[model samples]
Target chain A: MNKGLIIAIVLIVAVVLFMTQSDKKEVSEPAMTKAPPPVQVEPSPAEPAAPEVSLQEAFEMNRAMYGKGHSFAWNGEQHTTDHPEEIEASKEATQANAEALLASAMAKNAEVAKLGFEWKLTGDILKKAQQSIDQGNFQQALNLAAQAKYHARIGIEQYHYAQANWHLSVPE
Target chain B: MKIIKTLALNLAVASASQAALAADSGFDMQTVDPEADRIALQNYFKARFPETEIADYVNGIYAVDAGSREQWEELEEFPPYEFDVEKGEELFNTPFANGKGYADCFENGGIGIRHKYPYWNKDEGTVKTLEQEINECRTDNDEEPLAWGKGAIAQISAYMAWTSRDKVFDIQIPADDERAKAAYLDGKKFFYAKRGQLNLSCANCHVQGTNIRIRADLPSPQLGHVTHFPVFRSKWGALGTLHRRYSGCHKDSRSKPLKPQTETFRNLEYFQSYMSNGLVANGPGARK
Candidate 1:
């Protein structure tokens, strides 16, 4: 029994000693292993990267708004938005559309002063619409634009009415 | 037994040492190109909105003309042009129902802390932005996270940017570390990811020429986007956090909006800031 007890104690002590020494050795080893150098990422170039737009969406939206090989037509005159040469042609068409309608209204009213009042009101509404558009208030601008369109329509209607009904002074 | 015990000890020590080294070698800012960035930015804004008085409105809109470090410092006292800075400041200190404020969750209430974004957790292989950082803090403290575009996150972001006004940005994405690289890659994927009914990606309008049709404008590319964030938008009539911008972009693209500070957005912010490294910080800017 004494021999057995002694052997058991010796074994336990040996195990403990081995553990302590091993721990020390392990602790010291990491100090020697240098960490691997950092991976170097190649810096991306400075200029902007390639475009990321969905080609389909761009193509479709463009096609819908300005059709493929489309032409802009006003008052039996044809023009193209894509062509700078046709810009003047389009602008003149729009102006003529506005002017012809205005002339018809003025002819019906016969009173030059009344026509002047309507024009002034139309200008005032357009100015407000432009101001709102510049301010990024899109909803407000939309409302103002609608109002201007309505007034312009009324101006044309009144011009036609005066031309048909108003008495022209027969010149001596 | 001794050999096995020795092996375990060696592994533990190795990991601990590795951790220490990783933390020590933080980010390096020397690689950032300043002049190229400036030229790109100048070309971007000039080509897009040339009719506007960009130079005059640089303080609010254009990031370039917002002045040097010294100028930003001086403009600090004045409320940023469109943001409700004073209101944001008041809200920053206000405690939530859980009896905690923003200071408890962040270092220095997140002031002048615009960089080091889009961080990833290698263990999870995921990314996080500043907004996500804030929300995580809130969750840890048992407080409800604020909704995007409204409430604390937006206000706090505005206030943080305002306080950080005029410092140059220096975001770092660790290339050497496996984890850091994953975060950056994830961020890149997000920037390019396309979604929504509009079927648009964040890169679509911001990266593509969609800005071309609306006006002479094209959205600024990802490069140099990090510097001016948490801006005061004229459309909102209030200061907006970076997270708000993310949500707005998502909404604009017709995608379901992500919560403010969500992990996905945080990673995106990290990637974005990384691109704009070395640009002067002009947070709390007024934008159209």
Candidate 2:
């Protein structure tokens, strides 16, 4: 009587436990499924966007690079030279800078009128960029713009650099 | 009271140290002696290039480069600059709209005066190039100043330089005036100063690279740089003033060029011309 009673009790308890465990699994599966899709979507595509940046952001980065770029070739900021669109933008910025500098040079004295030819070269390069754009040669446009920007930057630096360094060449 | 005495002692020591520092490292102004510079410069070129005749120095890099010189001499026979000289003569003799002429503002009727230019104007406290003088002459006569550095001004300069052939450069620095000395010194500084994106000075080319060649062109010795004005270049296919050449060089170095006749350019002209004191004027010359 003791052995039969013990066997029956064991079978009954095992069946009950198994049933409860299966119920729990069934209850948890849909909840887990429903919760995951949107959450997974949110993080993978959203926050630590490591690989890519927008064009505007890229341009800002470029500006920072040229303004404070790490290359010894530039004052630290290497202009956005590698990319066509960014180079085009940089050309406009440089042209504006050159024009502003030219005006400033003029205001100090009307003698700045003499630098018309240098500024004309900037305009000519810009024109070349436009032609490149018309020809759908964006890379060529970028190259031209890059060259124009360099000239513009140089033009802006011309008067001041001369003023600052001319005295250094003075005989002691 | 003790603090006051300590402060007073510190001040005295500071003054003494500063005085000593100044004595050791002062501003160190170089006295302007154009004649001495001319002699030294001549000796330098002469000693460095014993084969080159002193008179031939005015011929620029050609004087030292026989290969380029042989080709250059043949080119000079026809002398493409002839048209420019003729045009310049006409422009020089023409009167301004104000009924006054260029002759009215210059000595010797503006003829044979290229060697006398880039003079330090004692009254103006600035240097003036022949280019500047030509513009000034026009402006003084109620005509607008000619555009210096190129074009018509260069033509007039070409004519003037041609007419002034055989005349020696005679740049002066008044020994009594400290400003003149400062101008000359400043010009020298500019010549030697490392500048631009390339960090080059005038000396980098004219002084050091005179014996060297880049591609096909040789940098000429600085001895007679001023004797050639408004040179006709094969590359330009047009005449260019020395200042125009200066601007181009600066641009090549990734630096901006100052306006023509600015104190910087003028002072440089003054200094360079002074160094070329005895070189014969052989401007309106040709170059490749």
Candidate 3:
């Protein structure tokens, strides 16, 4: 073969070999790296994993949280007091706090009711709480109010969970 | 070239990760397709109860078990709601205080119209149920609106349903109206969404839990649920409308019941009636 022709042939063969190798790498590389990493679901803080709190536990928690006049937050509002002594010194002030808690429970119940997720006992419990208040039994009223609030909170959580997961129950 | 390859690989990996996340979340917000849903629901029951005839579903729990069906047939021979239907017929024909009566307001003097409701009223932009319209008819003619759930309302509904016996439900969600579609979707959401302290949806019992005993009673299949209404339940010992049954179910599930003829319930009836599209109306049924 002529010298120039032989050189050109060599270059062509080399180029074809390189192209073939590149195509092989392109096909095989994605396959090797295509295994998707396992997805980790971080439970939303706003959403409860399940309705785990019992009525008794909810009442006790509310008693500890509100009975001491300890400051706490719920539904994005801060329920607090600068004067703990004022709460302790005045029986009327304590009664007011109990009434306030009952009102809060009512508001929460109404929120869930709009979503059509209100529990049957929530309204009944709140009514009893109001009755207790009417009878001047502040402690009993507070307990019932706490229980009602618990039901309302759980209902709200259920509403959110259902919004996201309801389609799973749909028959395929 | 190496940089380009790395960028491509990274894009592929990111896409895969997003897909995996979506699968793990299992979040789906699908558009409302009533016809598709109806087919799936009917097919589900058919597959679930292969022996039960499709037409027999209007019989509810009795349709599932042969023993119960035999007893139900016996009960049917001396149907409990016969008296209610007769009273309903009288109430329906009696003229209102005004010169006009219920016959004046509806098509075909309101006979054989049970299956036509609960319909979407385009002008009202809401669902119009048979019971609701009955009350409206009374009020429109200078008469008092009847009490919902039971009593006169149920009696009237029973007479109307009797007139509609063997007529299949043909509820419509108008194609041109967004409100009608929204109402149906809302209702479907209500049916599937878990509520109350028990965390139970309507589907939990009637759909997935059909034929399964809950306490002493077996839950009925959701298919053809609306076919039989204004039932004379042995528990009540009186005739009651479908909303009465809905209220009872809510109480059973520990959820606060919505009032009868309310928007929520009217929409629910719209969805359920649509689901029972092909089934024959067999209302004023008797149940234990």
Give, for candidate 1 chain B, the lowest lDDT window spanning 10 residues. Answer: B23-32
Count of backbone clashes, every candidate in sequence: 15, 13, 0
Q: Is the docking of candidate 2 incorrect, acceptable, medium or high quality?
A: incorrect
Q: Score the docking of each candidate (DockQ).
A: 0.01, 0.05, 0.27
Model 3: per-residue lDDT, tens digit, A65-126? 67755565444445553232233233443578679878988998999998889999888899
**Residue range B181-268, candidate 2, lDDT tens digits:** 7888777656755555554567656765565654445788788888988899898999988888888877765455676677888788
Top candidate when judged by DockQ against the true structure: 3
True contacts kept of each: 0.00, 0.09, 0.64
Pitting candidate 1 against candidate 2, the one with the higher TM-score is 2
For residue B234, model 1's alpha carbon misses the true position, in angstroms, by 2.1
TM-score of chain A of each: 0.30, 0.32, 0.47
* Models ranked on DockQ: 3, 2, 1
Model 2, residue B81: C-alpha shift (Å) = 0.8
Please provide, for model 2 over A8-63, each residue's C-alpha lDDT reduced to its tens digit, 9 standing for 90 to 100. Answer: 99999999999999999878887657454444333464555343555556655666
- lDDT tens digits by residue: candidate 1, B130-183: 666667777787877766665566666666667776666665555555656545
TM-score of each: 0.44, 0.60, 0.74
